[model samples]
Target chain A: MSNYSKVSEFKDGVKKGIPIGVGYLAVSFTFGIWAVEGGIPLPLVVFISLSNLTSAGQFAGTGLMLGLASYFEIGLSVFVINIRYMLMSLSLSQKLDRSTKVGQKLLFGYGITDEVFAIASTREREVTAHYMYGLILTPVIGWTLGTFMGAAVGIILPERLQVAMGIGLYAMFIAIIVPPAKHSLAILCTILISVGIMCLIKYVPFIKIGEGFALIIATVAASAVMAALAPIKDREGDAHE
Target chain B: MNKEMYYFVAAVVMALVSYIPRALPITLFTKQIRSRFIRSFLYYVPYAVLGGLTFPGIFYCTDSFWTALVGTLVALIVAFFEKSLVIVAAAAVLSVFLSGLFL
Candidate 1:
């Protein structure tokens, strides 16, 4: 692609991803304050918001951190929580420009998340470096800013309000998944299994494992089982040409 | 252990590492997705994730399975008919809170 086209693509991605960015930042703001309230450091909360950019994983991570879990435990929890994103990005790999450099592809792969993937997957042509860059920059900034703001204002917020904000993160999840669930059975099954497995982890007798390990085992076990039993077959034509 | 400081450092390190994985792929890959397995996985995976997250959200609270069950059932019923996110969450929360209060 020409330099002009690349720049424009990048600009387009930034624009498309802005809503997602705004939404993420608002939610992460809560995360930031929660981390501080939970006894985490302000700068560290900022870094987590800036770097991880995942609501569920960070929530789970901080929960574990508060419990004084071991490093191995934390690592395993994060891995399981985020393993699905790897799948999401890998699926998105097909939409990129075929001739794009492998090095660039590897570098940009880090930005794939529910919102970014949702926005970029709808693109009609091969994705460009500029497009991915645009998508990442906005959301990254939003998440970072929210976290910083949250940490700075952590003390003033009422405890009840902070707890209520946790629902915001959950609301985002519902927004991401519910619209699609109305259409697809595979997704419905996945949701069912994920919840079922998690509940089992929480209540089942011998399975009273820690949350970190429970999250890992539940995700893997559920995904693997779902993959084997209910493999999704292509039905409709590609939405974007 | 300077618990707060330890968490702060841990958050930064995790944030960086996590971003690396998320950002790297989108930057690098630019082609038509061709993998059938991955395509299928992507298509259905969202539901699994949502169910996984939501199920626990509705059920994890309360003293026993009965309260959790009642709360979640009400929430699901409300969520099914209602498009509003707030209503769905409220249904779940209110159900649980009322059950806890009355029981």
Candidate 2:
């Protein structure tokens, strides 16, 4: 690609990323306060945000840490929480431009959060390395910056307000799944099945499961059931749309 | 290990587990997946996971059950309109804060 086009694609990617960055600021800010409130040090909280760049994984992992759970539990919970990214990565890999190098793929692969994958995969044109980099950078900055600010200043916030902000991340999750769920019965069934399974696990006294394991069970069971019941015939065209 | 050392190690492990899933697939798999079941499974994973993560947990996020419920309803209403993430999230937080005052 020409230098001008590469730069423009990069700029366009940044433009698309701005909203995601803004959204991340709110969610990660909540994460930061929650993590610190859980007894994590300020610096470590920031470091976690910088390295993980994921809301659910970071929250679960750090919560496990604060509880003094075994390292094995921490690793397993985080991996389970984040395993969805692999499917996203696989789907996005098919959308990348043919000329994208292996090195570029490796580097940009690290940047494929849920929001990034959603925007990149929905694009009309094939995704490029430059565009992915631009898209990734803004959110990373916003996530890290938000974490730092929240951890540093969160203690000063009123108790009620802090508690209220706890709903932000879940609200974001609702926003994400609800739109897609509204569009397709299959998706709605899949989500309902997942929630149903989760409720059973949580409420049923005989079935004792950890939160991480519960999530895995719900996700796998729901997806498998829906996939079997309503398999998508047109993988390429119908999958993305 | 000491407490600080333990936390650091945990962070490293979490980071590794997080990165491997993301980096492994895109870097290693270039070909389209052929299995219809797997493709469909992958397609539904996001919704299922997000759904599982959000509910039950969302109800307990705020101080009171009533506030959380109010916030959840507001979120559902805003998101039903296909509002942006920030707006939906902010609406929930604001609703919770406002409801906390009354109840």
Model 1, span A15-107: residue lDDT tens: 877766765665676777787887777777777776677777778777888888876677667666666565556556655665667677666
Candidate 2 positional error at A173, Å:
2.8
For A87-166, candidate 2 gives per-residue lDDT tens digits of 67876776677677888888878778877876676566778899999999889998998898889997334778777777
Which candidate number maximizes TM-score? 2
- Proportion of the native interface contacts kept in model 2: 0.76
Poorest 10 consecutive residues by lDDT, candidate 2 chain B:
B40-49
Q: Candidate 1 residues B11-85, lDDT tens each?
A: 655565466556555554554445655555454444555556555764443455666676667655655564554
Off by over 4 Å in 1: A1-19, A34-44, A56-81, A95-108, A113-131, A155-163, A209-241, B1-12, B23-38, B58-103
Among these predictions, the greatest lDDT belongs to 2
Considering every candidate listed, which one attains the maximal DockQ? 2
Give per-residue CA lDDT, model 2, range B39-94, as digits (tens). 77776776777788787888998889999999999999999999987799889999
lDDT score, candidate 2, position A75: 97
Candidate 2: give the clashing pairs.
none
